[model samples]
Target: RVRLFLDVLAAVAHAHNRLILHRDLKPSNILVTAAGEVKLLDFGIAKLLHDATVPAAATEITKAAGRAFTLQYAAPEQLQDGDVTTATDVYALGVLLYVLLGGVHPTAAFTTAPLDQMRAVIEAEPKRLSDAVLLNSAGGAAAVKLKQARALRGDLDNIVARALKKAPTARYANAALLADDLRRYLNDEPVTARPDAIGYRSAKSLRRHRLGVAAGSVVVLALTVGIGAALWEANEARQQRVQAEGLIEFMLGDLRKKLQPVGRLDVLDAVGAQALAYYAAQDAGRLDADSLGRRARALHLIGEIAERRGSLDEALRVFQRAADSTAELMARYPQDGQRIFDHAQSVYWVGYMARQRGQVPDAEASFRKYQELAQQLTRLDPNKLDWRIETAYAAQNLGVVYLESSRSAQALKAFVETRDAWAGIVEARPEHGFELGNTWGWIAKAREALGEFDAALDAQRTKIDVLRKLPDADKNRIVQRHLAIAASELARLQLALGRYPLAGRAGQDAVDKFEVLVATDRANAEWLAQMTLARVILAEIQLALGERAAASASLDRVAADTVRLRSTDGTRNKWNITLLGSLLLHRLALAESPAPQRQDLEAYLATVESAVSGGKPLDAEQTRIASAVELALGDLLARDAQPAAARGHWQGAAERLQATADRGELPSMTLLAQARLRLGAKAGARSLAQRIEVSLYRHPAYAELRQRLAAAAGAAPGTP
Candidate 1:
C-alpha cells in the first residue's frame, strides 16, 4: 500500500516540479498497472500554478472550471473557491494515501447528508488513517484489518495528518517535500514531516548550550587555537617532557572543566589524541610510578570522552586498556585499594557499554566482577561511605541488566537491596539523599515491570519525595533533571492506576520542568526533546481526563518539536518509541466509543497489536505495554458476545507474564491468577492468588483477585 502511494506520489511530484498541480487526486485517477507502474490520470482539471513567464498558464482555471475537481478529493481552498496552490495537490495526495492505506475516504464519511459536503471539505478534519482503517474493518476479518491499521499508525499517520491540514498554508509545501518525507519513512530514517532527530540536532544543541557563544565560534575556534598552541609549545623544545605533560594534563583536567561544559567535544578529542600519542612514545618500563599513574588516568579520561560522544566501541577499547594498566598497577601495589577501585571503575564502564550494546553475557560477567570489587572495598574499610555506595551502584547496575532481560524477581530484589543501601547512607550521612532518590526510581521501574502498579506508584512518589528534599532543588540543574524524570514516571504510574488528577499534576510538572530546562539551555536540544516526551505524557493524561481538545492541542504542538529533537537524541529509539507509544494511546483513547456499555476493545486491540507487530519486534517495555492491551481485550471478550475468544488473549497475557511469575514476582503472580481465572482454571487461579496474599502490594486488587477466583470457582453450572 505504502509503495503504491509512493509511486503515485512520484508521478504527482514530477508534475508539481513542472508547475502543475493535480487538483483532483483520488484512487480512481491514480491507476496502477499490472507491471507495477503508476499512471497518474486526468490532469484535465489540474491547474497551472502562477508563473511570470507564462501568463497564459494560470490558476484562473479554478475560476473558469468553477470547482470542476472531484468534490471528494478537492482541497479546502477549492471547496471555498479560494486561490489554488501546490498545497491543494498535497491535500488531495493525503486523501489518496488515506484511501490507499486505510481503504476508506478521509472526509466523505462526515458528509452523509451530501449537501454538507462542502463544509466537510472546507472545515471538518479527517479521521486519522489508522483510526479509519480499524473502524472500516470492524465488520470482522480482523487480523488483516488490524495489520493494515498498525502499518499506518505512526509516521504514516503523522504524514497524512500533516497533508490534510485544514488551512492550505499548514499542509505540505509541495508534492516533492511530501515525497521526500515518505522516502525517509520507507528508508527507516527521520522524516522531515515528523522529525525528532536522534543525533545531529543534539550535538548542535549541546554545542550551543555548553558554550555561551555560537556553536561554531567556540567549537571551531577552540579546536584550531588549542591544538596549534599546544603543538607549537611542545615542538619548540622536545626536552620539555614534564612541561608538555603538564600542558596536556591541564587540558584534560582543569582546562577540561572549563572547556568541556562548552560542549566542544572536538577539543577533548584533539587533546586526548595528543596525550595518548605522547604516552605511546614514552618508555613505560623506565617511567616512574607517578608518571605511569598519570598515563592510566589519561586513558580513563579519554575513555570517558569517548563514552560521552556515544562512541561506546572506542570507549570499551580504551577502558579495557585502562583496566589492563590498573591491573598491572594493582600487581605492583597489591595493598593499594585505590588501584583496585580504579580497575573496578574501568570494568564497570566496560560492562555498561556491553549492556547498552545488548551483549548480555558480557554485561553480566562484568557487573558480577565489579560487584566483587565493590564488596572487597567495603570489606577492607567497612566504615567508608564511598566504598559502600560503590557496592550499591554495582548491585543497581546488575538489577538493570536482570530487569531488562526479564528476571523481574531478581531485579526487584537487587533494586530493593540498593534502595536499602542508599537509605542507610542517607540516614547516616544525610547528604546522600540524592542517591536514595535514584534507587527509588529504579525500584519503581522494577515494580512496574512486575505489574505491581500500586507499589510502582508508591516507589515513584518516594523517589520524587527524595528529590524534593534537596536544598533549593528547583534551582539545581541535576536535581531539576531528577525531579523531571521522577515526575514523568509518577504521571505514567498514576495514569495506569486510573488516578487522572494526580497524573495530570505530575505530568504538567514534568512538562514544565523540562521546558524550563530548555529555556535555561537553549543550545541543549536534549532538553527540548525531553520536553516533547514530557508533553506527550501530559497529553495522554489529558486524554484520560477527557480533555480531548487540550490533549489534541498538546500533541499538535509537540508534532512540530519532534523534528529538531531526533537530531540531538543520542539513542533515537527512546524518542521514536515514545512517539509511537503516544500514537497507540491516542488511538486507544479515541477507540472508546459512546456505546455506554463497552469500549471498542477490538479497535483498541487492533491498534495495540498493530503497533507492537509493525516493524522490529516490540522491545521489553513495549511488550509489557502490549500485554496490558491483551489483558483488556481479554476482559472485554470474557463478557462480550463471543466469550470463548477471551481465552486466547488471556492465555497470551499469562504466558507473557509467566517468566516474572516463575521468578516469584508477586504482581505477576496476581496477574497470572486473573488470567488463569478467566481461562476457567479455577484451582490454578486460586492457588496463584493465594500465593500472593502475603505480599506488601498496596492495591486491594491483589486480594480481590483471590476473592474473585474463589467466588468463580464456587459459581453456578457451566460458567466457562
Candidate 2:
C-alpha cells in the first residue's frame, strides 16, 4: 500500500517541480492497472502556478457549473482560500493513505450531510486513524480492524494527522516529504513526523535488535545494575543542558538587542561556538523536549550571527536545520503556544534565508507558512501583543516578496495591512519603537512600486519621523541606519516628482547620516554599499538642481564604491538599478559637446535598452532605470537641436516608460507630453497631465509634478 502511495507521490512531486498543482486529487483520479502499475488519470483542474498567462489571483481552478473537490479529500486551505497549493494534493494523498490503511474515510463520521460535509472539510478535525479503525467495519472483521489499529497507533498516526491538519502550514510541505516519512518508518529510522523521543527511539532500536538484545540479556542496559551512577550521569547532563539553555537565552534575547547598536557580532562568536559544541556532543535522540527547544533556539542565534558576519551559506544551513528541528518540536506538542511561536520564527528565518538566496518560490512558501502560524497564534490568544506583533511581521515579509516580484497592487494591500497592524501595536505598546519606522518604509516601497510617488514620499517622511522618535535615535546604529535609509528613499521620491529643493534637503540629510556611519564602520560591506547608494542618489538630486560641480564630485567619490559593490555585493544588497542610474546621470552631466558626447550617450543607451528589452532578464527596478536612460538620451538629442530625432526617441521612451508603469517619474512624463506636442497632439498631452494632477491631488509633494505638468503645457514642441 505504501509502495502505491510512493508512486503517486513521485507523479505529484514531478508536477510540483513544473509549478503545476492537481487541485482535485482523489481515488477516482488515481488508478492502478491489473498488472499493478500506478497511473494518475485526471488533470482537468490542474493549476499552473508560474505561467505568465495566468492571473496571479487565479491560481485555483474554477468550479464552472459546480464544486470541484471530492469533499472528503479537500484541504482546509483549498476550501477556504480557493487556492491550489502543493499542500492541497498532499492532503488528498493523506486521505488516500488513511482509507487504504484503516479501511474507511477519515471524515466519514461527520461528512454524511452535504451541507455539513463542506464545513467538516474546512473546519472539523479528521478522526484519528487508530480510533477510526476500531469504530469502522470496512476491514474484513473486528480482528482485522484491531490489527490495523495497532500498526498505525504511533508514528503512522502522527504522520497521517499532520498531513490532515486544518492549516496548510501545519501539513507536509509536499507529497515528497510525506512519502519520505513513510519510507523512514519502513526502514526502521526515526520518522520526522514524531519528535526524537527517547522511548520511541529505544523501542525502535529494540525491535531491530531484539534477538541480539535477548542473546545479551537485554543488552548492556539491563546488565548495568548501578542506578546511582546512571542518575549521576543524567544529573550532570541535565546541569550542562540547563547551562547551555541559559547561555542561549541571554545571547538571543538581551545580548542580541544590545549588539544591534554595537556592531557586527564578532564578540559573540565564541559564545555561539560553545553552544553549538555543547549541543553537538549530546545524542539528539536522547534529549528531552526542553533540551531540543533550547538546541533549536541556539541554532537560530548561531544562524543569525553567521548572517550578520556575511557567512550566508552557513547561515542558511543553520537556519534550515533549526527550522526542521522546530517543526518536529511543534509536531510533538502541537497545541503549545510557545512551541507554535518558536516554530513560526524558525519558518520565518528559513524563508528569509531562501529569499536572500533568490529562491523566491521557496521563500514565498515558507513565508506563507509563517503567516499561517502567526494567524494561528493570534487565534490562540487575540490579546497577546507578542503574537499580534508576529502577525505584523508576517504581513510585512509577504509584502516584501510581492514587491520584489512586481505585484504592486497585492504588495500594496499587504503593506497597508502591515502598517495598520503596526499602528495598532504602537498604540498598545509604545515601546516597540523600531517597528514604527520599518512598517511605513514597507508601505513606501509598495507605493513606489505602483508609481504612486507622492504617496510613497509621504510614507517615507512618516518613517523618518517615527524613526527619529526613538530615545537613542542619534546614537543607536540600527535607528540611525533606518533613519538614513528613510531619508535616502524620501530624496528619491522627491526627485522622481521633480521636487528639486526638497530632494536636495532630504538627500543631504541622508548623506550626513551615511557619512558618519561609513567613517565609523569602514570595513562593513553592507554599510559601505548603503552609503554609496545614498551618495549616488544625492548626486542625481544635485544634477537636477544644476549643481554641476557638486554632482560631479559626488559621483566621482562614489564611483569606486559603486564598482566594488556591483562586483562583490550586488546580489546581497540589491542597489544595482540606483547605481546604474548614477553612472548614466554622471555621463549626462559630462556631455557638454554635442557630436562626440552624444555618440557615447547613444551607445550606452542602446546597450541599456537591449538589456532591459531582451538581452538579459532584470527585476522591475533595473528595467525602469533602463527606460530612464532612454529618456536621458532623448533630452540630449533635443539639446543638440535634433528635433525630429529627439521626438522619435522621446516617443519610443514614453511608450516604454508607460509599459513599465513609471508615470510618477515627472521628467519622463514631461518628455512624453513634449513628444506628443511635437507630434501635433496637444490635447493628448494636456489630458495626460490633467489625469496625473488629479491622481496626485492633496499630496504635499503634488506641487512638484504639477509644476512639471504646467511647464509641459506652456512649452513649444522640441523645447529641451
Candidate 3:
C-alpha cells in the first residue's frame, strides 16, 4: 500500500515540477491509494523552486518550507538554515518510507527528538544494513550473507539510508535519483548501496549508506515486533472495551433517568446530555454520517440538559459538538447553514452557556457566530423577523452581562447599538416588537443607574407608549410580559422621585396584569412571583400612607403565596420569595402602631437575614429590604440595650443604604433621614429631611407622614 502511495506522490510532484520538494512530509497527510499508489497531499504548503510553476488554480500565497514541515522529517540544513531543495524532500520521503515498511518511525516509540539530536543522528554517521543482519546472525555463512544483503538483494533499509543524507550536497538530489538507486539494488546489480562498489567515491557513499541503514533497521525491527505482538492480543480487548463502555453507560442512563417524570421541564435535557456524552466518545472515529449525526444529536441533547441544570460548561461542550457536526454536514453540502439552524437552538444556547460560565471571550465569539448565522437567514429571507429578533436578543443579553459587571458605559453603548439594529424591525412584526419595549426598558434602567432620571423617564415612557399602542387583539403572553416590565420600571422611577402615590398606582397596575395572567396559567412561576412582588411594593406604599389594615392585608397575601411556594419547592430554590415576603411582613408589623406586633416585626427581620446568609438568590430590592429589616431590628435591639448586635446590624444597614443612595436609587427619604439623625450626622439628616418633606407634603400616599413632619417641624425646625 505504501509503495503504491509513493508512486502517486512521485506522479503528483511530476505534474508540478521535474523535482517538487515536498519538504514537510509525514504519515498524517499521506494516504494509500487502492492500487497501492501513495497519494501525497497538502502541497499547497510545500516548497516550489525554479522548476515549479505556481498553479493557476491556487488562490493564496503562503510561505515556502524549511523546518516549516514536521521536525522529525526535516533535513539537517533545512532545520538549521530554512533551506529549500529537492534533497530536503528526499530526506522527508526517507522518513516516510521507514515508517511505512517498519510500522514506526526510525526512533524509540516514534517520539519527536530535539533538532540538535535529530541533526546529529542524520548527519554524524550511518551504519550498514548488512551490519544489522550480521549482529543477528547465527553462524559464519549467515554473517557473510548479512554483509552482502543490499548488494545481492534490495534492502529497503539501505535504500532509505541513501535518501536520508543530512547534508543536501551528499544526498540523492531528487526522488527520481533515489528511485533509480532502489531499482538498481532490486535488480541485484553490483549496486552503489554495497560498501565494495567499483569506484572510490561510490564505495565511500555505499559504506555510509549501508551503516545508517543498519542502525535504522535495528530500531524498525524492534518496533515491528512490538506492534505485531500487541495486535495479536488486541482482538478480544477491543471488543471488550466497546462492550464494557456500552453496558456501563446504558446502566447509568437507566439509573439516572428512573425518577425523572414525563413532561418535566427538563425531561429533554437530562436524558439528552447523558446520551450525548456517551455517543460522542463512542463514535469519535465513526465513519457513517448517520451514526455521526446520532452522536451529534446526543450532544445537542446534553446541551439541553446542561442548560436546564444551569451547567454552562457542560452545555457549551455539547453545543460545540453540535455545531461541529453541523459544520461537517455543511462541508458535504455548502450553503446548508439553514439546515443546521433547522435543528434545535444550539447556537444561541452556546452563547448563553458561555455567558453563564463567565467565559466572556467565549460568549462573544459564540454570539458573533450566531449573528453571522442570523445574517445568513436574513439574506436568505429578509422577511424573517425571528432571525433579526434573535440577533438583537444576543446583543441585548451581552449588554446585560456588561451592565451587571459595572460597565454601564459599555453596556449603554451596546444597548443603543442593539436598539438601532432592531428599530428597522416592523412594529407589525409582533415577534420582535416586544423586544423593542424590553430593550428600551433596559436602556431606561441603565440611564437610571447613571443618575440621568429624565433620560430614564423618556426611555421607560417610550416602552410603555409603544407597548400600549399595540392592538388589544394582538396583545398576548409576550405583550403582557413587556407591559409588566415597563410598568415595573416606571413604578421604580416614580418611587425614586418621591411620587409615592404615582409609584403605587404603576406598581398596582403591573400586579393586576400579572394576576390576570396567573389566573389563566396557574403554573407560570415567573408570573406568580411578579404578582407577589407587586403586592409587596403596594404594601410598602400603604404602610407609608398609614393605611395599616390595607398594608397588613397586602402583607398577608404576600406571606401566603410565598409560604405556599416555599412549601412546594425546596427552601434553596424559594429563599428569595421567602425573604421578600418576610421583609414585607416585618414592615407591616412595624407600621401596626400596636406595641405587641413590634415583636413579630423583629422575628420576621431575623428570618430575612438568616435566609440571605443561607445563600438565597435575592434581587437588589430584596437585598435593600434585608438591610432595612436588619437596621430596624438593630434599632429595636439597641433600645432594649443589646448594643453589640444593634451596632453590627445598624452599621451594615447604613453601609448598604449608603451604597443605594450613592447610586441615587434608594426609595427611603424619611427613614434614611432618621437613620442619619440617629448616627449624629445632623447635617446629612437635615439635607435628607428636606427630600423627605417633598415626599411627605406632595405625595398623597404619605399624607400621615406629612402631618407627623409638620408637628416635628415646629419642635425641631431643621431636625431629620
Candidate 4:
C-alpha cells in the first residue's frame, strides 16, 4: 500500500511538473491491475495550467471551476471560488490517502446533506488518520484494523495535516516533496514533517532504540555480576536502575501510545496511579534525583488526568506536589536546562489550575511566579523560541487576570506586550497562525475595555480574518468558538457605530454558525450557551429595527433552550439564569409595544423581580440583565400612566445601573443616564449622558427615552 501511494504521488509529481492539475484525484482515478502494477487512470477533470488553449472536451472542466467539484475531495479555496493550484491536488491526495489508510471519509459528519457536505469540505478539517482508524476499530473485530496506527500517530498525521492545510502556501510545495518524505519514512529515516515537540522526539527515540537499550542493559548486568562479592552491591544498584528505566519507558512509551489514540483518560489514570504507587513504595531517602524526576512526571500526569475529569481540587493538590518535586530536582540539578524547563511548566500548570478554580489571589501569586520562571528561562536561553512563547503565554494569562479584575490599563499593557511577542513569533513561523489569532482576540477585548473602539474593531477584524483562514475541524472547537465570539462582538461594535445593517448581518452570521455547531453536538452546553448569546444579540438588533415580532421570537427560542438545558442537567445553570433574565427583559419590551399585552407585561415584570429577589449575589453579566429588566419594567409602568410608581421603579433601576457603571462597564453608563433622566434628575442625567454616544439614542426603541431626556433638560424634543 505504501508503494502504491508512492506511485500515485510520482504520477501527481509528473502531472504537476508539466503544469497539469488533476482536480479530481480520488481512489477511483487510480487502478491496480492483476499483476499489481499501479496505474493513474483518469484525467477527465484535469486542467493544463500553462496553456490557455482549451480542447472542446476540456471546456466543461474550465467552466466548472466553482460549480463542479467532488464535495468530499474539494479544497477550501476551490470551494470558495479562489484560484486553484498544485496545492489543490495535494489536498485531494490527502483526502485519498486518509481514506485509504483510515477507511472513512474525512467529512463524514455532513454526509446526509449535499450542500452541508460541500460546506464541510470547504470549512471543516479532516480528523487525524490515527483517530479515524481508532473510531473505525471500535465497530468490533470485523472492522478494519489499522496495524500501523501507532506508527502513524505523529509523523504521518503531521504529513497528512500539512497536505490538507487550508491555506495553499502552508501545504507541501509540490507532490515530489510529499513523495520524498514518504520514501524517507519507508527507509526508516527521520521524517522532517512532524511537530518539533520535545516529548514527541523523546518518545520516537525510545521506540527506535528500545531493543538496543534492553541488550545493553543485559550486557552491563552480566559484566557487573562477574566482579563477585565486591560488586554485588553495585549489581543490586544496577538492577534498581534497570527497573526504574523500565518503569519510565513503559509510562512514556507504551502507555502514551495506547491511550493517546483513543483518548482514554480513565485508563491513563490507572496507569498514572500505579506509577505513583511504585514511587511511594520506594524509600524516600535512598531515591536518586532521576527517580524523583520520574515521580514528578507521574504526579504531573495524574494532575492532568484529574484536571481533565473536572476534579480541580485534586488536580491542584497533585499539581502542587509535582511542582514541589520538580523544584527539589531543580535545586539538586541547578545547571540542568531540561529540569529547569520542567519545573517552570509545573509551576505554570499550578497557576493555570488556580485560575480555573477562581482562586483569584492564589492564581495571581502563582501566575506571578510563573511569569518570573518563564522570564528566567527566556534569559537563560535567549535564542529558544519555545521559552519565549512560554513567556508570552504567561504574560497573556496575567493580562486575563487583570482584565477580570477590571484593571483595564494594566491588562491593556500586558496584552500589548503579549501581542507584540506573539506577532514576532508568528512572523518567524506562520504555522502558529492559530495562536496569533488568539492573541489578537485578547488584544481586541483589552482594547474594547479601554474604550478604544476603533482599534478594538480593527483587532476584532484581524482576529476574524485569522480564524477564517484556519482549517475548520472538530479538533479546533476553541478556534471556532473564538470566531463566533469575534463575530458577535463585531456586531456590537458595528451597532455602537450606528451601522445597523452590518450589525444585523454580523449578528445573523454568528447565530447561523452557532446553530450549525449546536446541531452537530446538541449536548455541548458551551456551544448551546454561545448559541443562546448569539440569539440575544440578534434579538437586540431586531429590537433596534423595531421588528418586535422577530425580536420576541428570537428571545422565545433562547428562553426555551435555556429552560430545556436547565431541566436536562437537573440543575440551575447560572448562565441560563442570565439568559432567562434577558428573555424577560425582551418579553417586557414586546408586551409593552404598540399592541400592548398588559397581563403578559405584568407577568414578565413579576418574574424579573422574583429572580432578583432570590438573594443570590449576581455576577457582572447577571447584574446587567437584572438592571435591564428593571429598566424595562419601569418603561412599562410609565407607559401605563402610573407616574409615581414608574418613578420608584426608575429610581431602583438607576441605582442598579449606577452600581454596574461604577464597575467600568460602558453599556451600564448609558442605561444609568437614561434611568436618571426618566426619574427627572436632569443635572445628574446630563452629566452621565455625556459619556454615552449619541448613536445609541438614535435607535427607535430609545427614541421615547431621548425625547423625555430632552424635555427634562428644557430643550426641544428633537434636540440632541
Flag regions of model 2 displaced more than 4 Å: 1-225, 241-264, 267-286, 357-361, 447-455, 518-525, 563-570, 573-581, 584-588, 591-619, 628-659, 662-720
| Runs off by more than 4 Å, candidate 3 | 1-391, 402-410, 427-430, 451-455, 469-475, 567-582, 585-619, 658-660, 666-675, 684-720
C-alpha TM-scores of all predictions: 0.49, 0.55, 0.48, 0.54
lDDT on C-alpha atoms for all candidate structures: 0.70, 0.70, 0.57, 0.69
Tens-digit lDDT track for model 3 on 1-720? 334545744654463343245667777767767776667767756654542466644412424334366776667776576456666777777766655543344432335457555655555543443343444334257646555444323455556666665456445555655565565444433223322222433333444566654566677746644554455345234323433332333223332243222213343444454565455566454333433443454465556555444344466777887777766654554554444453324566677765544445556667677667667766766765666666677678768766644456677888998888777775556556666777888898777666566788899999888777666723476677668767777776776666778887887887777776666544444456667766766776666556777777777788787765544333322334344545444454555544434466566556555645654334444545656566566767888898887777766666656655554442444445445555656567667556645432233323433344445456632333
- The candidate with the higher TM-score, 2 or 4, is 2
- Model 1, TM vs. native: 0.49
Candidate 4 RMSD to the real structure: 18.0
For candidate 3, the clash count comes to 17
lDDT of 1 by residue, 1-720 (tens): 677677887788677655677787877887888998899888787766555565553535446764778777778888777888777888988887887677777877634665577777765667777888888944357787788778778899888987887766556667766786788688664453542233323433344455543446667767655655565444334324433553455456544554544555466778887777887787766664545565677788887776555455677787787777777766777656677787788888888877644456678899999999899888888887878989999999999888877777788999999988888888788878888888888888888877787788888888888888887886777688888988998887777665779889999999888877666544444456667778888887887687987887787667677655544432333444445445444545554443212254455445445544543234455444555567767766666766767778888988877776786665567677777777778888877765665444433235457567657867643221
lDDT for each residue of candidate 4 in 1-720, tens digit (9 for 90 to 100): 666899889788777756678888777778878987667766766777744576766765575843556777888888788877777888888888888777777765425587887777765656787777777744345333445577568778877876776667556656766786688677554453544344323433444466764567677644533443334445345335534543443444434544443444355666666666776676644656655665677677777666544456677888887887888877877766567777887887898776655445567788888888788888878997878888988999898878755667888899889888888998887767787788787788777766677888999999888877876633565677777888888887777666788889999888887776565545445567778888887888888777877897898798788776555432222443466667666666566543434454456445545544543334445556666666666677788798887787778777766655775566666677778777777777676555554323233334555576787767887653
Compute the lDDT of residue 126 as modeled in candidate 1: 78
